[model samples]
Target chain A: MSRKISYREAMRAAMHEALTNDPRVFLMGEDVGRYGGTYAFSKGFLDEFGPERIRDTPLSELGFVGAGIGAALGGLRPIVEVMTVNFSLLALDQIVNSAALYRHMSGGQFSVPLVIRMATGAGRQLAAQHSHSLEGWYAHIPGIKVLAPATIEDARGMLAPALADPDPVVIFEHAGLFNMEGELPDDWTVGIASAKVRRAGKDVAIITYGGSLPKTLAAAEILAADGVEAEVIDLRVLRPLDTATIAAAVAKCHRVVVVDEGWRSGSLAAEVMARIFENAFWELDAPVVRVCSEEVPIPYAKHLEDAALPQPEKIVAAVKGLFA
Target chain B: MTRKTPVNQKIEHRPPPPPAGPVPWDKDFALQLLLDMLRIRRLEEKAAELYGEGKIRGFLHLYIGEEAVAVGALHALAPEDNVVATYREHGHALVRGMPMQAIMAEMYGKQEGCARGHGGSMHLFDAATRLYGGNAIVGGGLPLATGLALAAKLQGETRLTACFFGDGAVAEGAFHESLNLAALWKLPVLFCCENNLYGMGTAIERAEAQTDLCVKAASYGMPTFAVDGMDIVDVHATMQKAVAKVRKSAGPVFVEFRTYRFRAHSMFDAELYRDKAEVAAWQKCGPLHTFTARLKAKDAKGGKAKLTEKEFLELDKRVQAEVAEAVAFAEAGSWEPVEDLLKDVHTPEGTVTAAPQASTKAGRAKSPAPRSGRRSSKPTSARGRR
Candidate 1:
């Protein structure tokens, strides 16, 4: 049995289930309670869960995020929501310095079981300040697990496991995907590791995640019309890049194209391509190619923003160039 | 051709003298407080010697002149409460019951250290004592302390979280943010500011627009206290009341202990910022000798001696012996092996049940999995690439 639901609904349902299931789990962030969520993800959560569980924090990212780390250390499962990745920079010191380094620095005496959720990507014309995908930067950290939920099922399932994790977990939800509608399987179960092969094919592997998944899949559909079958791999977990699945896809397709929303230089796509080269260089038929955002601050102009991002047309061109 | 610039006038710096009063504590308790101060003084003195000898390396911020703050405030808290301190936290760790041997071993980077040789002098952590960290960042521990109190409030725990930082941290954005958050949430946190006058070489007057730190905290709408940090009696009395209010009301409180550090900021700093006379003036009011003097002061009206000079020497001798034992333990402690360097980066079983797909790989690798979860497929060979 399956039902169609929006990504926002899926995420809200997951948080609701978590709150109902565990007494230790509480949500704290700016506008999480009275203002609902920044994206209205927690619209009625305040009334449903009460003020204590659905906490509305002051505009103190460093304070609340560090508090979340402390709360996790002091024995509470905290779901700290930063409105967007751009604003998370205010709390980056706490996230990178204290939350990520505590367990290792303490020699295993403490583990921060904290889940920090933030909106990412640039398609809402929010301009340079409010938009930008920095999930790739977070993926570079060693002490944290980074997740990007592109599908409704993943949005519905990733929260439970992230909260269950003993270390810090950062979840990046694409800002453009909140209203994206998809069918979620009734028994939607997902893990925090490994890449899931959304659409299996044998010609070439189209590896993408988060906001770029829809664009890459659309590009694959166009490739399919032209009789060039492309395997679509949704990298749900980004930190420990499911190399085995990636290598397997590389072995089968023998060609890979990475699509990312982050800028070209030092992007997660660079890392993905580097890993593919490291693990499956012998299996590859050609060099792995990538389609990333242009090197510029995301502009607010509609055409300029569209051009700055990784689109289906651009992904198709990159895949076609690979065959050429 | 260059123009001649006007010379700026230099300002004079002078610290206040120690408070004059009879010893408030009984002979035994006063001796105990003196003993605690001596233990820290002796331990860090040995640490300085060891640093000179190349045995203990890294930034060593001694609490030589600010001993009364840690000694007084820490003793006022319950054992169940949490403590968070700054880099100059050897005194805090000792007073909170972390074995001196383990602290010395940590400075030695030995395997027997509290942090297993991972964190040096700046990052001591003890889970049993509920000591959160030896946080090195200026304003880093404030938010952590606030969060710990938030957890306690939410979980209905009676324990309070006491966070200690230097005057320098008051200039940080994290300090203001943490204070506001703690006050807004009404969390039970005791913010202890050890105002040692200088952040590295910059004086509080030169760095902050408002030198009154308690006012900065008070602006956050929490009760604030300014106490004479050199007097252990004042620090302990103020902390007792502060802790009581926090535990009773489950709200935040701030205390500014007007203290000073006698030594250079770190091992490398030169005492060029302030005059030698200024240092001598603060030394005249040093917590150790001043408190000892008050204990030995003759009541002009003929009261009993608070603490005899003989008892003071006995406590000093005992503290010296303990410090010697700690140094010996550090010398005997071994180094952690290179092979186990990555052991505790993440929890050992972090990937066991969290990732259901990885279980198949674990099975093929013949590794025992910790949690039995829903399996995805019939044991696919991990080696099956093509």
Candidate 2:
């Protein structure tokens, strides 16, 4: 018996299940307790989990993230939400130098089974400071896994497995997906290492993940309307990327376009293109083109902010440009 | 504060000795402690040799002169207690029960190393022994120790965390923050500051405005002590007492092991930090030989005898053999696969919750609603808002 739910509800259910099932699992972050999370994901968590587990931390990312590492070391499974990726920079030392490096550096003696969840990507009218996608940066680190969930099924299923992993894991929830509503099968457990093909087509492959999936799909719909079949592949896992699926898509489509909110320079878009080049270069009819955010700070102006991010029109144009 | 001391000595109070002089432990236990320290000494000596050979690279901070502090201090605690040490912590890891093979492998950058070769000399970690880190960042482990202690306290465990750092760590903000937090929370953490006179090349006198390490700790309302780290007996006794006090009161304690390093700070040092004469003067109080003499004296009082000069020579040969074995183990250990480079940062469970099935349905269903929030829609200009 499957039903529809919002991305926010699915995430809430996962967290609620974790807290209810595991005595050691606890949630902590800014506004996670009383204020019900910065984005309202934990609206009823404080009352449900109480202050001990549903802790609200001070505006000290380094302190709390380091504390999360400590707590993980001390035999607790901690889910630390950092509001967004932009704020996670403050705790980069703990995340990069400490958490990610702990297991391998400790001669494989210790494992930091900790999870850090944060909102990511750009969209909405929120200006430069609040907007941006940086999951690609986190994927660069070794000893840790980076995840980006673009749909409701993923929102409901990633947390439990992340909690079960023996090393540190960072989950990037695209800000654009939280309010999104969707359906869930009664039996669907999404693994963190696989990629999904949303819309199958043989002419062109549209590769994207996180917030850009919707836009990419919209562009695919437009391409289909014009009798140009475009395949849409969703990259659920960033690190240890399921390149097999990407290769399969590119191998069949013959042409590909990568849509991302990250800047074009040294971005995930570039990495995807490189993968296509490595695996399906001979199969490609044209060079891989990417529709990424403009290479500038997102502005405060509403139209400028929208203009700077990947739009449906932009993705459609990019997919069309691939044929040209 | 009440005053009663030899005025000058009052400025630097020595720790009060235990009432029973010291426990008359058997020769086996005594020799075991000595062997552990020697193993560290010889292993580090070979590391210096390897650095010279270019087989090992990076900042190789050897614990050459500071063996007794780790050896004696570690012997005082149970295996269940936690340990947090600095970059110069090969000796601590060995004594805390990390196999010499792993430590050696780690130094050699082999996958079998303590941190699986991910952390070299500066970062040794042992999960079975509860050794928390090979933390390279100055003053980084203090807060971690405090938090571990806090967790133990909250969980109703009688465990304690002993954190080791050089005197230079006193200047870092983490040191003060940890001390205050530990004291305020009454967490059971034994702050063991190895006052080796220098933090890298800078002498403690030059780096610190107030050189009294114990005084700085005492300011946080924690009980403090200063010990002669060059003397294994002093280090062992003072640590034993501090451990007892913290266990009974269940609060934090601070001890400064006034020690010295016989070698350079790292492989690159040119011996310009202090005079060779000063080094020679301190070597006279070398822990190994002097501790042997003290052990013999104590054994003689028991109507038996300690190990003879030949036994000491034999012990050194055995330690050297162990170190050699460790090096071979490290040399032969494998490297972690590049494919797995991204495995453990976060667990593999997160990909499940990312893109929901319903979201896919929603994308396929009615009008697509824009998912929007705090972050900007544009990629290039992402910054965190307060």
Candidate 3:
């Protein structure tokens, strides 16, 4: 049996399961309770879980994020929501210095079993401050695991295992994916350790994750129309990148084009390309290339915002360049 | 500099601190408090001596003059309560029941330390005591304390969290945000601010437009109390009241312990900020001698009361011996192998829990501690003595 659901609904279902199954699990964030979450993921959780479990916080991101780390250290599985990736910078010190370093710094005496979920990407026309995709910055951190779930099944499954991990896990839910409609099969399970091939082809390997996955898939379809088969690999776990799966895909399809919504320099795509060079450099029939956002603050104008982020046309162009 | 006026001049116009009455707690408890303060003083002196000899290397912030804040305040709370302290936390770690050997070994960068040498002096941690961290960032631990209080409330536990930060943290955005959240949520947190006047060479008058700090916590609707940090008696009483109220109401209370740091901020500081006369004046009002004199004079039963000159000497000798033993233990401790450097980066996969080192003699034997260092013969005068 399969269930048709929005990515937002699937995420809510996952949170609802965790909150219902575990007494230690609670949700806290700005607008997560009374305002039904900034994305309305917890529409009825406030009334159901009560104010104690479904907490609403002030604009104090650093304070609450630090509190979340403390709550985790004190033995509660807290799922904190930072409304967006941009605002999370305010709490970066707590996340990087405190939460991430606590377990190691304390010499295994502590582990922050914290999950911070935030919306990222540049489609909302929210301009400079709110529209940058900075998941690469988070993935660069060592002690924390980063995940970018681009599908409904992952949206419903990753939270459980992320909550289970003994360290901090940051989930970047691209703002564009929430409203995406997808089907969830009864036994559709997911793990946060490896990449998944959404579409298979023998000619070229198109690698991406999060919001860029759909655009890359679309580009793959466009390439197929031109007789160039493209295999699409979704890097489910951003940190601890699944080099084996990427290597296998590279072996089968000698040409690779990486797609990311972040700017070109020092992006997650750069890390992926570097890994590809290190692990599967000999298998490459062509030099690996990347389709990344332009190096500019995401603008408020609709047309400029579209240009600033990775699009299907850009991915298709990058893939064709790899062929050329 | 635009204007060459000295900022340390503001120290002359100081607020009148709370008075130190006779030893309010019974003889045993008061003596225990004095002993704890002595333990801090002697241990730091040995640590300073070791630092000079090049054994301990790091930004070591000795709690020479501010012993009463951690000693008196920690005594007022239960064992289950959480404690979050600033970087200058060797004293806080000691009084919270962490063995001196573990603390010293940690500063020595050995595997037997409280954090297994992962954290040095600025980041001591002990899960057993529920001490969160020796956080180095200014105002960093405030939010952690507020969250610990939140968890205690949500878990239906009566444990309150005590967060200690210096006056330097008062001007931080974190202090304001954490206070606002705790007040709004009614979390059981004790914001213990040790106001030592200078925020690393910047006086309170210059750093804050409104030098009165209670007004900041008050703006968040928190109940505020200011006590003389030099008086261990006052520190204990104020924290007792603060802890009790916070537990009863399940709300946060902010207490500002007006104190002084008689030493340079750290081993690295030049001591160029304040006048020597001011240090001399504050030393006369020090928590140790003043309280000792008051205890001796108020003994109505005369000559052989609980805290006699002989008893004080015995306690001092005991403290000196303990410092020597801890130093010996640290000297004998082993460094962690390079291969195990990545061991605790993230905890090992299995669902392991915190196993705090035992504070008993059997526990101290966990490390191959050598009790061979020569003991200091007598209790020296207070450290950082120019």
Candidate 4:
């Protein structure tokens, strides 16, 4: 049985479960407790976990995130919320220099079992300071796992596994996906290793994840209506990118189109294309095409924002262009 | 340019010295502290010689001049307490009980090194010693120390966290943020600042507007103190008081030790940062010699903390031998297999389950009051390479 739930509710559910089950687990972030999270993801958490466990912090990303690493080392499971990916920039030194690199640099003696959650992407016109998706920057690092939960199931399920992993895990919850409704399966088990084939087809492979997954699926539907069966692959895990699944999808489709909200220059789509060139170039019937946001600060205007993002229409056009 | 290794061959042929300060009821205890400091100094001197030989690579931030700080302060800390240190931390690791052999082997990049030879000069870690790391990034360890303190407080462990950073780290945002959080939450953390007066090339006066570091710490509502870092007596006395205060209260305390680095910042340093007169001036108050002089003066006055010059030389010889053994142990250590590179990138541990959906629970997922500022657009997808 599948039940419909919002992305925010799914994330809240995950936190509640972790706190209730594990006495060692705690949540800390700016506006996470009495303020109920920057996105209302931890609403009523203060009353439940109290200030000790449901900690509300000052606007100090580096301090709190580094503290999260410390807490993990001290045998506590800490889920640190960074408010937004843009603000996570303040804590980048801790996350990249310390948390991500600690285990590897320490020659595996120390592992940071910390989970950091942040809102990423640009769709509601938060402007340059508040909006932007830099999960790719984190994904590029070797010591940590980067996750993007495109659906409600992922938003709810990814946290537990991330916290269980002895290394640091970064979860990027797209701001646009908070209100997104989805029917999560009763027994859906989301692993941190592989990608998921959201929609199956053989004509063209539409590879995307996170905020762009829904749009790519929508575009595939439009393509099907036009007599083109476009397959859709959601790359759930970004770090050890499930290249095998991606290759299998491309092998069947022979053509690939990647959609990402990040700008075109050196984007996640670029990595996907590079992998295809390395692993499945001979099987590719057409050159890979990428549907990415315009290389501009996400504008505040609705039309401009829509034009700048990877829209379903754009994904459809890119898919059609690959065939044309 | 062709300076000798400073091994001081004259100080290597005597007997063990008597106590220097208030001798604890346990005889030979003060000797242990002296031995610890000597071990650190000898190990670092050996490290410098190896650096010259090109055997130990990377930034060799030797903890030569600051041995007494670690020797005295670590003696006052419990094994359960958390320790966070900056890059110049060979002394801290040794005094905290990380085996000298492992630390030397780590510098050699041998698999038997403390971090299995993966972390070179700047990244030593000993989980058993509760030593979080030899964090190289300036001011990076402050927040981590704060968190460890918070966890200990919550767990009712009665343990405190000691954070060691250089004067250079005072300018970083992490330092300010950590100070504020540690004070506001009243977490049990001992912020140990080794103010060496310079950040690599920049002097303290040129780097900070307010030269008073304790003042900055006091602004965060924490009790702050400044001590003579070169005097092991002052470092020990100040740290004992600071740790007690933090353990008794529910908050943090800051201690600034005004110390000097006798050696260059790294082997690569050109010595253009400061003048020779300044180095020579600080060298006159070097911890070992001054403390030895103080002991000899006390002995002349018929005090309990008495030691002959010959005995001090003997202790130095023992420490030198220990350091040589550590170096040989490192040279004999093996390299890690190249195929194991992917291991420990993430914990090979089993996965965590997904968080449940909150909307179905009705009472769990209520939206809180909206943020005050103008709202931004929803976030975009992660762009650029995965």
Candidate 5:
């Protein structure tokens, strides 16, 4: 009983299910109501769920987001959308200082139980302001959980577990993946703690997550045609990373190519490669290499933007470089 | 909307002695108000002493002159109500029912501290009393207080959330946004702006175009009240009125408590901002001395129960001894083992609600509720709080 659905629909479905089932769950963010969400994820939710549940907020990210933390503490589940990761910077204090630190600072007296979702990554020609892959920066924080949902299944499934998790969870929904069509099963509910090996091969491993997963899988197809089998690992959970699964993948393939859209200097790819080194250093057949975004603000020009990001060719090149 | 911004706004602070000579109330309750204020006055005096003795470290913000605001405002709210305070919060925590020993132990970085010493001096937290935190960031507690009020509304609870910030926080976006949100949503929030004239070094008039905080807060469409923060009677009166409106689920009320800080902003503050003359002038109307004078006045001159010198000294002696016991408690408190350093980062496994099945009454984690006046319930599916 599987049906084809877009990544956006899966996300909407997850939110819809959570809102429909639990009285505590409510969506609050700019344009989430009235405007039906900047991404149209909550298009008709305002009518279906009403404005109280499907809340429309002003251009106050820090206020509403911090309100979400308080609401959670007050004993309600709040799904706070930031519109985009770039705008999340305005609310960074509430997220990093208040939400992330509440439980620890309160000496385990309070758990935020807040889910903050924001669209991340570049591709819509939205220059520097509207586009960024800053989930890695959030992953650096200790108290909050960071999730990057790359697949339709994850987009549909991850919200429930995230809302269920006691601590603050930031879900980075790649802006490029909203229209991504894939088969979603009747049972799209999946656990949020592990990474899924999207495609497996014994020769070399190509690891990535969020928007880069499809590109890495495409690169694997290209590698397969060239008689070089590439195993693909999709890092679903960015924080509290599924190290055991990643270690097993590295041990199986012996060589790895990490792809990330964040900048090369202190990118998530760098973290993945570092973890591989620490956890599976002895299992490596060759030194791991990473393909990260070129160091520059993502440009407005399509060609320049494409060059700044990790494409299938870039992933293929990085994998071939690993084999060489 | 443009106005001439003053470079150095001279605060024409005429510390008026409270006009209401005798607040006609029960003798015990009236004495209790004085008791609470004296307790904070003495506790913080000891805290400042301990800071010098090297027993406490890391930004010990003393509530020296601002004792009236914490005591008066907090006493107005019920225990079931929520409280969010700023870094200068030992007075708020103590008055709100957090044990002075735990507060001192926290200052000593002991496991017996309210936050298990993780939060240190500026970050005391007590879930049991519903004191959300000693939020160090200026304007940070506003949104948290607003959100807590939102939860109260959503949960259909009558308890209000009392949030205390400073004049400095008025310059922050969190303050404006929180005020706007709370007003728009009509949440039950008691916004206590402890306007101690300066935000660190910058005076309110210098930093803000509109020195009138009530006007700025009223722009958000919420009712605003100004109180003589240095006067306990005014502070208590203003809070009772504001809390009455908010407690009825009327909406958020923004209050500016006009007062002054007698000390530097932090242990590190060189305090090159304000002049010594100005500080000395404000000290002339210190809350404790003036209030004590009023209470101990002759019975014919509006003092119904003239608090005799003997009674005042006995009360002072009691608080002084309590401060010493708190210091002893901190000294005897043990350090949390390094092995437990990694603990409480996340709700330890099994306490959190595992992924819910569709449409089930989210098997509530049996954790103590964050706030519980008469509004206590089994909370939500989130990880166990305490």
Candidate 6:
């Protein structure tokens, strides 16, 4: 049986299942317990799991994140929540220097089975500090797996596999998608690699993930009405990018448009476009185009912030340009 | 909160303080500690020589004057307890049971090295002994130790995590945050601060407002102690008490082993910051000779038999031979193949398999439904497969 649930509830259910199933699993982050998580995703978990498992932490991102790595080393599964991608910068040293490099640098003697989850993207007028997507920055690292769960099933399914993985995994949940409702299957099983083609089309492949997935999908529907028939690919795994699926998409549709919420310059969209150019350039019907956030700090004003981010209209426009 | 004007006080260069208590005089135990210190001294001395000979490349931070800190404290902890150390950790790795041959080969960047030549001198890691890493980032290992302690606590294990860092790490925000977190959670962590007076070329006094490291740690409400890092007996004794308290789940304890580095911070350091006279003064009371002198003091006093001159010579001889054998092993060690350079980035199970070739079929091939009879017992699923 399948049940309809919000992405936030689906994530909460996943974590609850992990906590109940594994004694070694614990959740630690600022206000994860008492304040019921910054996004309220962990609401009521404190009372259910007790203080030991659902731990609230001070605003010490570097300390707790590093502690998560250490706990992983000491034989415990820890899910460290950094509130948002913006705040994760405070713990970047630990994440990059310790968590990402430990396994390879330690000559594979230690595997940090640590999971770090953070809300990403700018849509709620949070301005420069809280806004901006940096998942691409994390994806650039070699030793850690980067996951962006766009669907309700992915939100519910990704955490278990991530917790089960022996290396460090960073899961970025779109801040905007927390309240989005979708149906989750009773046996929703998903892997953390390869892009899933959300909508099939022959004209152009609209590749995107995370917060941009819905926008691209909406744009694809718009394109479909205009007889463009754009295929939509949700790149669930960012690092160790599923190039084969991407290449296949490119072969199926000669034209491509990459939609990303991160800034246009040196963005994940750029990397995806580059991969297509490298792997399937001969199959290209036209030069690939990208619809990304403008290269500026996401402004506070709603109109400007909306203008700065990639929208469905912008994605549709980019796909039209690719066809042109 | 009004900010106070910073005072520019002239710092005084001083020798390492004397031992707080009498040497725990047990012949075998004392000899074992002495031999451990000697092994580190010989191994590092040979490493420095190799660095000069162009055999060992990269930054080499020798634990010449701070041997007692690693020797004494590591000996105090049980074999099962975790150890996290900083980049200046050849001595800690040696004391933590990493083979000298592996460590030497790692310094030579050979396939047989502890980290399989991936990590050079500054990144010695051994999982068997739970020596996490030779973390190069200042104050980087502090939170890792805290997390390890948290894991042990969560698992209901009595094991303690002993972390070693230099005084320079005290200035980092990670140090303060980690200390507060460890103390707040009452995690079983033994923070052994090796205060060798400088963080690279920057002296502690120049970099820190509160030069007393133990005072900084004590602010977190944990039991903080200062010991003579050059005194092996004091270090071991202090560690014993600290380890016992942590094992009893009394929360974290901070021990500041006040020591000094006899060599430059790394091979690249010109050491233009400190006076040569200060170095000479610290070297006068170096852990090697001072402890040796104390051990041989019984002979001069005509007291009962303790560590004699002959015993010291024999131990030194054995350490020198071990160092020689380690060098030979490193010399014979082969280089890792360039083709395998990309390996170990992720565990084999977690590796991202190559995607299937793009199909021209009309519809996307749906992944087979997961076998419903048995739950997915494997922690990680195969990538690029249904």
**Per-model DockQ against the true two-chain complex:** 0.27, 0.13, 0.28, 0.25, 0.45, 0.34
> Residue by residue across B1-386, what tens digits does model 2's lDDT show?
23333322313223222212333567898899889888988998898898888878888898887888999899999988999999999999999988888888887777777776777899888767888888998888886787677557645678899999889899986688678767876889999999987888776656677788888999999999999898787788899999999999999999999888889988888977677777877777777766776665644357654666788899999998898888888777788888876554433333321111111211322211111112111221211210
Candidate 1 Cα outliers beyond 4 Å, as residue runs: B1-11, B299-303, B350-386
Candidate ordering by DockQ (highest first): 5, 6, 3, 1, 4, 2
TM-score of chain A of each: 0.99, 0.98, 0.99, 0.98, 0.98, 0.99
Clashes of each: 0, 51, 0, 22, 0, 0
Model 6 chain A poorest ten-residue lDDT run? A184-193
Scored by TM against the true chain B, the candidates give: 0.88, 0.83, 0.87, 0.83, 0.88, 0.87
Find the candidate with the highest lDDT and give its number.
Answer: 1
What class would a CAPRI assessor give candidate 5's docking?
Answer: acceptable
Cα shift from native, residue B317, model 4 (Å):
1.6
Cα deviation of A245, candidate 6, in Å: 1.0
Fnat per model, in the order given?
Answer: 0.44, 0.25, 0.46, 0.43, 0.46, 0.49
What is the DockQ score, from 0 to 1, of model 4? 0.25
Candidate 5: Cα lDDT at A70? 92
**Over the stretch B1-386, how does candidate 5's per-residue lDDT look in tens digits?**
23465565455445555434665556577678888889988888888888899999888998889999998888899988999998999999999888999999999999999999999988988878888889999999999999998888876678899999999999999999999999999999999999998888877767888888899999988888998888888888889999998876469998999898999888889988777887888887788888888777656654346587889999989998999999999999999999999787887755642212112234532332221111111222233311
Q: Is the docking of candidate 6 incorrect, acceptable, medium or high quality?
A: acceptable
Please, what are the lDDT tens digits per residue for candidate 3 over residues B246-291? Answer: 9888899999998888898999999787788877778876777777
lDDT of 1 by residue, B1-386 (tens): 02232333354456666866887677788887888998999999999999999998989989999999999999899998999999999999999999999999999999999999899899999988999899998999999999888888877778899999999999998999999999988999999999988899887767777878888888989999999898889999999999998987889999999888998888998888888888888888899998888888976678877878887888888888899899899999999999989887777664432211111212332222112112112221232211
lDDT of 4 by residue, A156-244 (tens): 77886776676788999998899998886666666677899999898999999899998888898999999999889999898879999
TM-score of each: 0.93, 0.80, 0.93, 0.91, 0.94, 0.93
Number of the top DockQ candidate? 5
* Positional deviation of residue A197's Cα in model 4 after best superposition, in angstroms: 0.9
Judge candidate 2 at residue B115 and give its lDDT: 70
Q: On TM-score, who's better, 4 or 5?
A: 5
Indicate the fraction of true inter-chain contacts that candidate 5 also forms.
Answer: 0.46
Expressed as tens digits, the lDDT of each residue in B72-146 for candidate 4 is 888889997889998899999999998899999999999999988778778888877888889999999999999
Candidate 2 residue lDDT tens string, A142-242: 87888888998888778877776767889999988889988776666567768899988988999999999988888888888989998999998898788
